[model samples]
Target: MSNLAILPILLPFLAGVLVAFFHKNLIASRIFSIIATVIHLALTIFIFMSVQESGTYVLEVGGWEAPFGIVIVADPLSALLTMTTAVVATAAVIYAPKSLSRIQEEFYFYSFFFLLIAGVNGAFLTGDLFNLFVFFEVLLMASYGLIVLGNGKAQLRESLKYILINLFSSMLFVTTISFLYSVIGTVNMAQAAERVGEVEQQGVLTVIGILLFFVFATKAAVFPLYYWLPSSYTVPNAVVSALFGALLTKVGVYSILRTFTLIFNYEVDLTHTLFIYLAMFTMIFGVIGALSTNNVKLIIAYNVIPAVGFMLMGIGIFTETSIAGSIYYLVHDMIIKAVLFLLIGAVTYAAGTSDLKKMGGLIHHYPVLGWMFFLSTLVLAGIPPFSGFIGKLLLLQGGLNQEEILIVIVALISSLGILFSMIRIFIGGFWGEADIMDLPKQKPSLAAMTWPVGILLSLSILLGVGAEMFYPAVSSIAEYVMDPELYIESVLKE
Candidate 1:
């Protein structure tokens, strides 16, 4: 069963390679991509369930020992995220055939999509830090192909900015990894942790930890560094935007969460405190960007930053409950963000524009889209009895328990800011007069596009409504992440 770990990464890469040659038979390509995604989702679910039952499973390549061979570890956290990634990718694929431009469809869009997802799963499951860097490159190259499929002025411009920044980060990442290897003698994460404990995290190692975090933060779209994301994501089509918005940045955050908790925490007083302040500012600046935007895509893109901050809030507090809350929140945001972007696509399809000022009274014509968009705002804002609430409650509780009063207040205010920013979209886009000029001449098949939105929405509802059922598992994941020794021991086979 442990051997099944490679399939999630390998299956998609093979499917993508196979699909690449089917350029002429688009109908055949769609079928193949859909089948591939469905299987990927199933594989991830099986791995998730197996990990829940069996604890972590580490697969070392080439039958070599840990620290000497490359290893893939399907721990509780990675398994859950990979499962969630598959779920989101499946929905994106289902919604894509009719939604993308003809040029995008004519090219190997789904092929690049598969490659990106394979890289994402590899990032989550790899136990080696250098392999993590390799996986980042894999996903990024795939994303570049996806972005350039647009070939429009905006897409080209934004994609250039997006690429340049990631390239800079990648260079810095390799340099930092080289420095880390020199000091620690291995890039196997477990070995790095073991060696860090032996040397005690101080002086040059602390510099390496912060430098490494800086690289991940850039990828995660933490503030100051996040200026690139809103513009870059907004320029892509809805499905691409949804995938980038919902999952890519989360990978960066996942890297941060894994590293800070596992290998970079000896100076918590300095490090975690920096996390709190940065998170606080991230939430503030992110919502400001969201509220100021009238472009529907821009609003959604900016909101992604605040969600990143919210997850970091849980991490900065560094409590078991807070970590649990962050994980729950992270999962919830991934689904809701996907739902929101898919709806953005539907809305623009019906309205023929992304500007909210030119849009009006969509509910009168498209009740399902309007209503779902409205409900999604509630979920995004963490209103009661929905998916976003429980994780937020736990985070807030954890903050108060630690007597971190100021940051907690900022988080609360930021939550309200988020609700207000999203409601503006609902009110402006769905509630006004039906402007005849704004409606598309040929009304889109809202039904075709929205089924994916509906599937993800139901999952979001389940997550919130079933929070108690999920509590024990989430807590265990929190425990698993908080203990560096467990990760080190399992990966080292000690």
Candidate 2:
């Protein structure tokens, strides 16, 4: 169990170093990454099984006691996220060869990829707040390299903006940590949770909380801080974009969830209300952007902002069911969004453009891709019998239980907006008229791309159909997150 707790992080770090040293040999680097990710996945599975049997596990790094030495903690929530990270990383790795150019491949892309995985795993498992900040830097530095690997005009322009925005956020993150450490006198998350209330700095804590919020909100692409996302992300290859799409913003969301639930519950009434308003605005603005965009990738990127809003709404409502629904929706959105982005990439690869007006009659030639996109669209729209539907159902029920009528209305309206924008894509991009004589012909080899999309789609379907099983797991996670004592006691004994 102890090994399970650490291997998810260790395997990737070791592999990343090995890949970086052997960067000149692409084949060997790829093989090392693949093996490392597979091992990481196995470790996550083992940890999941252990958690299922024992509830949670804690590992004191270097065999030192907690509150003094570093610790890694795995409860249901972190374990589940770790598992999701593994699955998405595996799929992105598979999709990379087709998406990355040979020049990009020579730049140690695989090493950075594994390092990103390692960072995410560390973020999910670490029991220390300072370690979380370290992991965020690790991931951000790797992402910066990946985004600029091509060094094209577009890549450089976007990378500069990306680095600037993320740098500001990182500064805020460090400041927040400094304040937190000063207040609690410990960086261990469990100990901090235990000691935070004892501090006589309510006003300072509130200030720090707001600072932390700004840091994460930027990373999560919440409105007003979201402009950098669409342009920056569009410059990367489809695989990198898909990976960032699947995992990066969610890291911020996870931090918000962890901190708010564990260490800052005292400010819930204030913060939760603020979150509710931000969520409503975020959804409205994101959908409007999606509706206005003609670029397929940009549309998807804009839609992601609203998806985060939906999850935030669940958090703002502050109910057991609502938080559980948020968890479910997060997992659902990550898989579906990755599949959608990859599908768009495949279309761009095939048609040599992402402009909706320039694409048409794709359904006739690429029925498989069409059907996959259609199914994903339905899932995104929260259509019945899909993963999105179940999540929305739970969220709405929680809102109703809390008498948050305005939020309920806003949620439904935003969902309709998703449906409407997706329809625009379907009609104009896939099914609309195409000049058959003028369209350039190319051999369709979307088979390799289909595998990742298929895996994602299958998982979405399974989650929806197996809701009975998943709900319990989600509920358990929500309970664990809402009460930090369970986590603290496991990691730091009295």
Which pairs in model 2 have colliding backbones? none
Candidate 1 residue-wise lDDT, 1-494, digit = tens:
66888889999999989998986688999999999999999999999999999888989888999999999999999999999999999999999976897789878898899999999999999999999999999999999998888698999998999999999999999999999999989999999988898878979999999899889999999877898999999888899999998889999999999999999878888888888889999999999999998998999999999999989889899999999999999899999999999999888888888888888898888999988998899999999999889989999998999999998999999999999998998888888777644555676668889998899998999999998888898999999999989988888877
Clashes (candidate 2): 0
Say which candidate scores most in TM-score.
Answer: 1
lDDT of residue 65 for candidate 1: 90
After superposition, candidate 1 runs with Cα above 4 Å error? 436-442
TM-score of every model? 0.99, 0.96
State each model's CA lDDT, in order: 0.91, 0.85
User: What's the TM for model 2?
Assistant: 0.96
Worst 10 residues of 1 by lDDT: 435-444
Off by over 4 Å in 2: 199-201, 434-439
* lDDT for each residue of candidate 2 in 313-416, tens digit (9 for 90 to 100): 88888888889888999899888888888888988887778888778888777788888888899999899888999999988998999998998999999999
